[model samples]
Target: MTAVHVTPTEGVDQPTVLPASRRDVVLSYIALTKPRIIELLLLTTVPVMFLAAQDVPPLWLVVATVVGGTLSAGSANALNCVVDADIDQLMRRTSRRPLPRHQVSTNGALYFGLALGVVSTVWLWTLVNPLSAMLALAANVFYVIGYTMILKRRTTQNIVWGGAAGCFPALIGWTAVTNELAWAPVVLFMVVFFWTPPHFWALAMRYREDYAAASVPMLPSVASSDEVSRQIVIYSWVMVATSLLLWPYTGWFYPAMAITLGIIFLIEAYDLRSRARDTEDLSIIKPMRLFHFSNAYLALLFVAAAIDPFVK
Candidate 1:
């Protein structure tokens, strides 16, 4: 394959050309937004609106929730990239991202993130409900300011607390439907809270060197794999317990799905933890699989809740 090279200006020795196969500047920009993570968060949000309200929320409401939440999440991820770009440039996984690759300027990222954030908040407020709008704003702040900026470098537990930023979608979507906060959504929030660490740390395990090089202090870089694996198991068990709590609140069908999925997650966690006696890279491969599956598990459980009204 021929490389597309970007030549630097007069003062710079070499110019950098971004990946050439991609077109659609908009798509590149969107890719910078980390759409998969946003989609997972949104997946948690939308179905809960239906579950909490016992039917599909208004079509306008759902559309508003999706568009607005996505924008907010996109903005948050973009800003995170901007803030961490220096460190990101050192990581093999993230080095190719727009910011790290020098394909997008910091100023451009900042302006785009803020523009998208404002538009998202406005759309949610105008079309969905004020509470969801507020929630979106909070999620953005929690991530960009609270988690990424402040806590990430300070503690190995960064993801543990930082993950809270991602949980607001459940509350936002629920309030969009019910117009008030309630315990059921709170339960869902707790579920995600417990789920984040093991999921993220599993990936971090593969990239510990990158994190160490970046001085990011993520769990895998900061803690022993044994410790991380232990935490994974503990959190996985707690996550399962949390899922069981939703039985009375969300509905029976959701509880069943939750229990079933939770058990599967626990087994995966156990496998990850048990294999940590030795650092055989191959042993923990399944943990990554679990991390990916956990995202789907959470989404499917929420979808079950959404459909529970008819069955009940």
Candidate 2:
């Protein structure tokens, strides 16, 4: 294949030539999937499967669910890249993504994403269960059509509600085990639902100018620092409380981990709120401290949940 040079367009600050190398093309397609975000989604997934089984789930079942979930998540993220391509070029944080960098054509990414969605549905229905497949498909549709197309640019509460799409992995994981829903998975789902805003708002706080430039209405971009931090504290408190609701399903070990992790998460949230209350300076607010800690908090909490059954 020959290298393709794309002319710089409006909203795109730099023109980039697509490399002809097969490896680069493959990697560009992978980048369209936003693999890091998929990792976080999967972290919530596999643990729930373990919790549902209350033992090691069949290795093959675990592998099949992971593969299906990856493809489903990749489809959603890739389509999001396609839809957000124009604004992505305007935002410094997203300018390097494959769509904005001209590494993948819009139509190419769109078709690839659609294809992944189809394959994931079929794969999950055949290998995991029909219910898991349906849940995964719903999540893809919600993330792309509901969140990316509808809510993201229109409202400051985009992440708060749109983040529900991300919460489906917990449901998918649970359904993949029992072919149905339960209060346990529902609680975990809400934990992730509440966790999403504070986690994303913190990152948005750091990239407020990026979202503002992109004309996206992320809360942190449009709201006052005090308002954003206050919202974070509020959501953080709710997320921690929701997490403890799982204590009824798990043993004492899980609650101990949940309480300790929740306390730390709350401290970081309150600290961010405290700093924001003191001043408007982004440098002093340090929202990313809470942002990074939130990642660790979610991962460790889920791991503890997965371990609780065995220890009990």
Candidate 3:
């Protein structure tokens, strides 16, 4: 096969070449799924499986659950790219995505998403359990219909409730282990639920004008910086408080880590709030500081949750 070559178009920052080989095509489709986002979802997942088992789960079960969960999230994100392609083109942050770059057509992305969704559902049902399969499907539906289709363009609070879709991994992880739901996983679910708003809002704060230009009403785009900051602080407190609820079940280590992480999280939130209150220049706000930290915060917290049972 001859290699396809791409060069930059005059005045364009990105290369204009299409995929030249089967490998490039496969990777382009995978890129449509937004694998980084899937990693975070899996971060919340694997920890809960360990916590649910109260020990390490079987190696095969862990591998199966992670694979199924990745496919499910990939489906949802690919569909999201399809649905959001229009606004995605308008936002500098997302303008180079496969759909906007024409590396993947809308129809192709849609079909890929649906196929992954179906495959993941069947994989979970056969290898894990029917309940876990259904929950994965429900998360996909909720994200596609509830968040992307219904709420994204319509509301300022889109991410707050839309984020419920991302919380399903904790439940899916727990069920994959115990084959049933329990209160501990529910607490983990809420931890991700409350964590979503502040985490997302910080990024939205940095990209407020991009969202404004795209005409999507993310909270940061529609509200005052002070208002957005206040809400971030509020949600930070709530997320920290919710993390504490696992203490009775998880014991000292989880709570100790929670309190320690929560303090740093609160400090960042408050620092962002202070900057918002004092500065008129949005560039000075440094919202990405909190955004990056939130990612680390959640990853570390959940890892601690997974390790808590072994210590006790």
Q: List TM-scores for all candidates, in order.
A: 0.91, 0.96, 0.94
lDDT of 3 by residue, 1-312 (tens): 111223322333443458888898999999988999999999999999998888889999999999999999999999998888777767778778887777877789899999999999999999999999999999999999899999999999899999999999999999999889989989999999999999999999888877887789999988888899999999999999999999888868899999999999999999999999966467788899999999999999999999988885
**Candidate 1 clash pair list:** 6-15, 6-17, 7-15, 8-15
Model 1 alpha-carbon drift over 4 Å, by segment: 1-15, 18-24, 280-286
lDDT of 3: 0.90
Error of 1 at 215 (Å): 1.0
Clashes of each: 4, 0, 0
Give the top-scoring candidate (lDDT).
2
Candidate 2, 280-301: lDDT as tens digits:
7889999889999999999999
Model 3 / residue 120 / CA error / Å: 0.2
Weakest lDDT window of 10 consecutive positions for candidate 3 = 1-10
lDDT of candidate 1 over 1-312, digit per residue (tens): 111233322332223446565564566688779988887988888888888778666887788788888898998998888787766666667766776566776787788888999999999889888888998999899999899889998988899999999889889988988888999899989988988887888888877877887778898888787888888889888888987877886557877787788888888888787788566464554557767877777888878878887676
Say which prediction, candidate 1 or candidate 3, comes out ahead on TM-score: 3
Sorting all predicted structures by lDDT, with the top scorer first, yields: 2, 3, 1
Whichever of 2 and 3 has more TM-score, that candidate is 2
